[model samples]
Target chain A: MKRIMILVLAITTGLGVLAYTTHSAPQADDVKVISITAKKFDFTPGEITVKKGVPVALELTSSDRVHGFSFPDFKLTAKIEPGKVTRVVFTPDKTGEFTFSCNIFCGSGHEEMAGRLIVTD
Target chain B: MKKLVLAITVLLVIALMIGVGVFKLGLVPVNADVPPSGLETRFIPIAVHASVANHAEEQPNPMVPTDENLIAGGEVYTVMCARCHGVPGRGPSVLGASFYPPAPQFTVQPSGYSEGELFWIVKHGIRNTGMPAWGRLLSDQDIWHVVAVLRRLNSLPSAVENSRSKLH
Candidate 1:
C-alpha cells in the first residue's frame, strides 16, 4: 500500500509540472505561416511583417546550397538545407524592426545576404 | 545478486523517463542570452578539444606566414570574421555578444587553437555554435590564408594592419 501511494504521488507531481511548463509551438490554425526562400545571396521577400503576440511560422527553403537563418533578436537560428523546408515557429513579444541574416558563409556576397523582420504591435 | 540487478534496472528506467520528460516538456532552457552553467563550462571545452584532436588531421600549416599571405588573410578576416571575432583596434561586436555561447573575441583574447585546428574549424563549423563553415564559400588556399592571419592576429604585419585600418 505504501509503494502504490508513492507511485501515485510521483505521477501526480509529474503531470502538474508538465502542464505548468510553457509550450511555444502553436497549433496549425493558430499560427500564421509564411514561406521564405533563400538563394545565393538573398532571402526572397527581403522584408517580412508579422503581428506581435501572434505565433508566426517561417517555412524556410534554399534553392542553391545549404543556407542558415539567424534572427538574433529572437534567438532563433535554423539551417535551410537545399531541397528541404525548415520550419521555424516563434511569437514576437516585442515590436521592432529586426535584421535576419544568413549566418552560413555562402559566397563572396554572403555578407550582404540579409533581410528585415518588422514586428508590428 | 538478482535483486541488486533488478534494483539497478528500475532506477535506470526511471532516470530515462525523467530525462525524456524534461526535454519533451521544454524544461531545458533554450535561450541564447543566458550564461552557460558550471557543468557546461567544465565539460564543453573538454569535449570540443577532444573532438578537434580526433577529427582534425595532424598536419602543419601549408602556407608560410608571408606578408602577402597574411595580408590576404586579413582581407578575408576583415570582411567575414571581424564582425563577430572582432578587429584588433575595435571592441566586441554587439551581435556577436548576443549569441548563446558568445562568439569569442579572438582579437582581445587570441585563440589558443593551432593552425590545423583552426583550419578544420573554419572548414567545418562547430555544431550548435554560431560559427559557420566556410568550406563551400572559400577555397582551400583562402582558408589557409585565414588561418595564417588568425595565428598572427596579435602581431600582424604593418602592411596587413594598414589594410585592416582602412576597413570601418
Candidate 2:
C-alpha cells in the first residue's frame, strides 16, 4: 500500500510538471511576423499597429536604396540595404506611439524617413 | 547718314554714363531685404518656363496613388519641402515669406504644371530660385514619391495626413 501511494504521488507530480512545461513553453509560432518594404525616402505602411506583449518579427525589405531603421526607445536598429530583406524580432513591452526613423543617409527626405509603431493593449 | 551716326554715338555715351553712375551711386537694390521689381517678378516665371522647353514629356508615374505611397510621399515632402511650400490650414510660413517671390502654397496647384514638368523641376531645380537640385540629393524613386504627394497635396489620405502632422 505504501509503495503504491508513493508511486501515485510521484506520477501526479511528474504529470503536473509535464503539463506545466507543455503549457508554458514558448513556440516559434507565437511570434507574429509582419513584412515591411522600405525605399529611398519612405517606409510603406508608415504606421504599424501591433498589440503589446506579443513577440513581433519585422521583415524589412528595401526596394530602391539603402536605409536604416532605428527605434530609439527600444534601442533597436537594423540596416536595410537595397534589394535585400533585413529581419528584426522584438517584443514591444511598452504601450504608446513610438517613432522609428532611418539612421542611414538616404536622401533629401532622409530626415523625415520615419514611421510610427503603435503598441496597444 | 552722318547725323544718324552722331546721334547713335551720343546715345551710347549716355547709356555708358548711366551704367557707370548707377554702379557708383549704389542705385541697384542688391539686398534680399528689398522686394524684387515688377519686371523681376515677370522675368523669373519666363526663365522657369523656358527651362521646361528643354526637357521632353516624361513617361507616366509607375507608382499608383495608394495610401502607402501617398503616406510615404507625404513623409518625404514634410521633411524636405514643407518648410518652403507651406502647409495647409496651418497659416503662412515665416521662412517662405522671407524669400523674394515667396514659396507657393502646395495646396494651390500652379496652372498647367503636369507631373512631368513638376518632376523635372524638382530634379533639376529652377535657376536663381530657392529650389535646390534634388537630383543630387534624392533618388529618382524618391522624387517620384514626392511628385505623388504633390498630386494629392490638397486632398491627402488620413494616414498621410496624420503622418504629415506628426512629421511637422
Candidate 3:
C-alpha cells in the first residue's frame, strides 16, 4: 500500500511537468522583419515573399497621409500613421500569394493602393 | 472550520462567475432605435473641424484653392471622392454605405471650413479613420483642386439640399 501511494505521487508530478513544458513552449518561429511604407495610395516594394509557419514582422509607416494596411485573409489590419512606425506580427498559416490593400481613401488614386504577400512551404 | 471556509469560497466564486457571464451576455436590445437630431448630424463635422485645425498647425500648407484650380480638383474627385462622397447628384456610393461609421454625406455636410483647413485635412489625413492624406503623392496643386471641388459640392445644381433628413 505504501509503495502504491509513492508511485501515484511520482506519476502525477511527471504529468504536471509535461503539461507545463508543452503549454509554455514558444509556438512561433523567429522570422525576418520586412518594412513597408505607404505614400500617396501606394506601398513601397509592393510585393514580398516568405515561408509558411515563419513569423513575419511588418514594420509599416506612412510617408505622407494616414493609411490602413489590411490582410483580409490573415484577419489583420494595421493603421499606418504618418511619421510613426507600427509593427504587425503574424505567422503565415498557408502557402500562397495573398493580396493586401489600403482601405483608407488617400485621394483620387486611392483605389490603386495594393500590394502582394507571398508565402511558400 | 476549513470545510465551512471552502464552501463559502466556492459560493463566492460561483456568484462572481455568474455576474461576469451576465455582463458578457449583455441584456440590451440590439435594435433599440434613437431619433436623429441636429446634434447628431453636426457631431462628425465639428469633430473633423477641430481635428483639422489642430493638425494644420503641425503640417505645412501645400495647396491653395481657387476657381481656376477647381476644374482640376473636379477631375480628381470624380475619380476618387465620387465613389464615396458621390458625384454631386447621386447619393453616397455603395462603398460608403458599408463603413462602420458611414462616410458623412459631404453634400449636406459640406465642410464649414476655410480652404486652408480643407487642404490640411486632405494632406495630413485623419488617423485610424478611413481618411488618407495626399500630401506625399499629390503635388500642392493637386490637393488644392480636391479641396476646391469639395467647396463646390454644396453649390452643385444637382446636389439636393437638406438631405441630412434622409440619412440615419
Q: Which candidate leads in DockQ?
A: 3
Per-residue lDDT tens digits for candidate 2, residues A1-121, read 9999999999999999999988986777898888888986778979999999999999999998777787868868888887787999899999999988776556555767788999999
Candidate 1's TM-score reads 0.59
What fraction of the reference structure's interface contacts does model 2 contain? Answer: 0.04
In candidate 1, stretches whose alpha carbon ends up further than 4 angstroms from where it belongs are: A1-121
Error of 3 at B131 (Å): 2.4
- Kindly list the per-residue Cα lDDT of model 1 for residues B1-168, writing each as its tens digit: 999999999999999999999999999999988888889878998999899888998778999998888887888788888888888877787777888678888878888888889999998988888888776456567788889998888789898899767765
In candidate 2, stretches whose alpha carbon ends up further than 4 angstroms from where it belongs are: A1-121, B56-58, B108-111
Instruction: Please give the range of 10 consecutive residues that has the lowest summed lDDT in model 3 chain B.
Output: B159-168
Please give the ranking of all candidate structures by lDDT, highest first, separated by commas: 1, 2, 3
What order do you get sorting by TM-score, best first? 1, 2, 3
Candidate 1 lDDT for residue B149 = 91
User: By lDDT, is 2 or 3 better?
Assistant: 2
Clashing pairs for model 2 are: none
Query: How well is each residue in A1-121 modelled by candidate 3, as lDDT tens digits?
Result: 9999999999999999999998875643466689999998789889999999888999999999888787878988777999999999898999999988876546556767889999999
What DockQ, between 0 and 1, does each candidate earn?
Answer: 0.04, 0.03, 0.05
lDDT by residue (B1-168, candidate 3, tens digit) is 999999999999999999888878995333313333467456966786687877675443344444445555666667656667665667666676554345556865786667787788777777644667655435456677677668767573222223321222
**Per-residue lDDT over B1-168 for candidate 2, one digit per residue giving the tens place of the 0 to 100 score:** 999999999999999999999999999766666677889888877877776856836667777888887877787788788888878667667787777777767765433677888888888887666888665445566678888888888788888899778866
Which candidate gets the maximum TM-score versus the true structure?
1
Best by lDDT: 1
